[model samples]
Each structure stands twice: as structure tokens, then as C-alpha cells.
Target: MVIETLPARLDPEEAKRVRQERLERIGSWLLPLLIMLFAIWLWDRICVWNEIPRYILPRPHVVAQTLYTDAALLFGSLLVTLKITFLSLLLAVIGGVGLAVLFTQSKWVEMSFFPFAIVLQVTPIVAIFPLINIYVDNQTAKLLLCSWIVAFFPILSNTTLGLNSVDRNLRDLFRLNGATRWQKLRHLRLPAAMPYFLGGLKIAGGLSLIGAVVAEFVAGSSGQSSGLASRIIEAGYRLNAPRLFAALILISLTGILIFLVLSLVSHLLLRRWHESALKQER
Candidate 1:
């Protein structure tokens, strides 16, 4: 028998869908880049047209040049901030997840303590920093505590929600099969909670960075080991607009990088089995 040949041309709808997917894939990144460049060009033109002094609004190129020239100082500060951020995130994860597990095991414990978590979350970090600053003598400890407070609640709440959200049918089935609490937790709840934990991780990552910077601003610490926030303050004091812009750019970039890294981690962890990470036919 002769082998059947596949069609050379795709159906019209299939061809249209393929083209759309290609366009979307390209446009997702390209459009944002184009818009960002346009915004920068507009900013430069506005500064030039208004005859603004460098002390007021430095041109993008000047800010870029400042980034290059001040790389040593800025990068060092970045390291300090990053250290606080990462340490805080690590602590938050440990505390949050541990607490969530306890809450899942005991409703009494959850009711007794969850309100305190809510209080911490609702209260602004600025309001809480003074207490942290007063109680914590070491500069790094102060920063770490502040960041941890900011990052902790999301993980606790999200993971708790996920753990509690197991299907009733599944629960009954496990019970019928004589599964113990530990078995259900390990085989069912934790796996189901993975997506929620990952989502919270992404949020906590950015919040940890923000908390570190904000804590720096509030503490107003100054020295060789101070963070980008201190550099921003110093730049403002000296009317170093270019340097201030550069510092701001670094903070923005750091937040973006944290989010991207967390998102990648989430995707990698969930891609094989989680519905959210699975590729959709559509």
C-alpha cells in the first residue's frame, strides 16, 4: 500500500491561530521594550526642551553614565540590601510555612494566632519599624526583622488557604482508605498547596526587597555598608540627580529580577503536574 502524504497547507483557522500565537509571543516582549524606549526618549526631550538643569532631572544617558561611574559604590550597597532581602525571605518562609502547618493540624491554634498575623499584615511597616528599630540594636538585625515582617503574612495566609482547600471527596476517600493525618498531609495537602505556596513566594520576594529599601529609608543608616536606599538619600542631599536616578533604576531592576526568578522557580516546580503551569491547548 502507498503511504498517505500529510497535507502541505494547514486549515485556514489553524494557520490564523498559529500566526496569532507567533505575534503574541513576539509582541509580549517587543512591545514593552518599544514603549520603554519611547518613554525614555520622551523624558530626554522634555528635559532638553525645558532647559532643565542636571540637578533637577538628569537625562537618561547621564543617569546611565552615572550608573557606570558609580558601579563600585552602588553595587556594594546593592549587596547589602540583597543580603537583608534574602535573609528576611528565608526566615519568612520558614516561619510562615511552619505556622501554616501547625494551623492545619489544629483549629484551636489557628484561631488563637491567625488574628495576630492579620494585625501585622494590616498595620503599615512604617508604623512598625520604629518598634523594630528601638528593640533591635544591630543595623542588620533591624533590617532583617522589618523585611521579615513585611514578607511573612502572605506566605502564611496563602499556604493555609491552599492546605485547607482540599476537595471534600478526596478527604473522604483518604479517610475511607484509613489514611492517617500524616499520610494525607504529605501525599495530598502539601502537593495541592504547592501552587499557592509558589504564588506567595513570588509576592514575598518582591515585598522583601521593598521592605529592605523602606526599612533603610526609615532607619536612615549611613556608612560604607549601607544600601541603595542610603545612596538615594545621599544623592538627594547633594542634588546628585543622575546618581539618584541610577539608584532608583537599580532598585527597580532588583525587584524585577526577584519577581522573574521566583516566577521561573514556580514554573519549574509546577510544570510537570500542576494545572496552572501546564500548557493550555488554547
Candidate 2:
């Protein structure tokens, strides 16, 4: 019997090259990242050298230290913000998709409600938050309602466009196959609408965060339970510049993480099927 050895794995040199390529990709991003860090550092240094009061501007290191010291409080506030955002987003997706389906089935309904959707999109959340607060009576409920209003439109618009925008040939084929409306929706429209839905989801994620912050800004001052916006407001009122800065940093990081997570989800869902995702390797 002939003994056949398996092919050797990547050699050290090849592995090193692969590592270098990854580092190079990361390195390409380094300059801009460093520039941002240096700018922050320089700003802090300048503020300190100018004898700027802590209330005016705190050092970056001081802000970072403050964050470390108050990690529990900061984290709790962050969790509250995240809860409102995600719950609102869940409601938006369900309601939006349901409305989209209704609109797709009824031209009259589409004509009646489409303009209202556009109106909602254009209206500032700040303008309506107080009304929602009054009607809802609970700060968290008002916040959720505001966030849902902000987030639902994108999903509705995108999914409706997708469902109704299917190719005529595909529709004809489905009809020829004796497919019911629901079957056509499930098999043909939904798969076709996934990209659009994902696009809307990305937009809605950011909008949800914005809605939460805006709602908190408008109505949370009197509430017992509050989100990160309250922490930011409290820090500012107390003239605790470092704490304020830390809260701001946390908010920024939260937004970035949401975007990153949504991006990854979009990639995972689309990579195998969508041309836009597959074009990367090409």
C-alpha cells in the first residue's frame, strides 16, 4: 500500500505574509485613527495649558478616568438607552412590515397613507415628543412611541417598494403556478424584498438611537427612570465636565457599535446571495 501524506498546511513564510497583509489593511486605517486621537490629546493639552476651568473643558485622560470610576452608572444608563432603542425598533419592524403588506394589497390604502408616512419622516421628533409624553403618561412609553415613529417609515417604504416592485415576469410565473397571494408574498416578494428590508433596518437602527436621545432630551427631565441623555444633562448642570465628556464618549461609542453590528448583520445575510455583497471578492 502506498502511503500518501496530506498536503502541508500554510508555511511560516506564507502565514507571515498573510499576517502582514492583514496588518497592512489595518495599518491603512491607522493614520486617520491616530489623527483623531492626537487631535483629542492636543485639545485636552491646550485646554489644560490655557488654565481652562474643568467646567469649560476637561482633559481626555480625566474624562477617561471618570468613566472608569463611574462605570456602573454609565453602563446602567447605556442599558436603558439600548432597551428603548431595540424595543422600539422591534415594534417598528413589525408594524412597518404589516403596513407595507396592507399597502401592497390595496392601492387606495397606499394612496391614503403614503403621504402621511412621508410627513412623519420629515417632521422633527422634537416637535411631537411633548404631545406623545402627554398622551402616554409614562416617559419610557413616550420614548418608545417616538422611536417607533421615527424608525417605522423606512421599513414601510422599503418593504412596500420591494413587494410591489417585483418583475412582471416573476409575477406572471407565480400566477401561472396557481400561487395564492400569500404564497406569492412569502416565496417571491419577501426574498426579493430582503435587501430593501435590510437597507431600511440600517437606517432605522440609527434613527432609533436618535429618537431615544431626542425623547429623553424633551421629556426625561421629570422622570424617575432616565436614559443616558439624563446622565449627560446631569453632568452638564453640575459642571462636571469630565463626566459629561465621558457620557458623550459613551454615546458616540454606542452609535458606532450599533452601526457596526447592523453592518455585520447585513453582510451575513446578504453575502451568499446579493450581488452587492458578492462584488467585494470580485
Best by lDDT: 1
- Which predicted model would earn the best TM-score? 1
Estimate, for each residue in 1-282, the C-alpha lDDT of model 1 and write its tens digit. Answer: 233774789899988987999999999999999999999999999999999999999999999999999999999999999999999999999999999999999999999999999998999999988888778888898888889999999999999999999999999999999999999999989988899999999999999999999999999853543899999999999999999999999999999999999999999999888888887754
- For candidate 2, the lDDT comes to 0.87
lDDT of 2 at 52: 89
Per-prediction TM-score to the true structure, in the order listed: 0.94, 0.89
- Residue pairs with backbone overlap in model 1: none
lDDT of 2 by residue, 1-282 (tens): 233663478788877876997998898999789999899989988997898887889878888899999999998999999999999999999999999999988899999999999998899889987677678877788889998999999999999998888989999999999999899989999889888988998899888988888788887677575688899888888998888888888888988888889889988999888876774330
> Residue 164 deviation, candidate 1, in Å?
0.6
Clash totals in order: 0, 0
In model 2, the Cα lDDT at residue 58 comes to: 81
What stretches of model 1 exceed 4 Å from their correct place? 1-7, 221-225
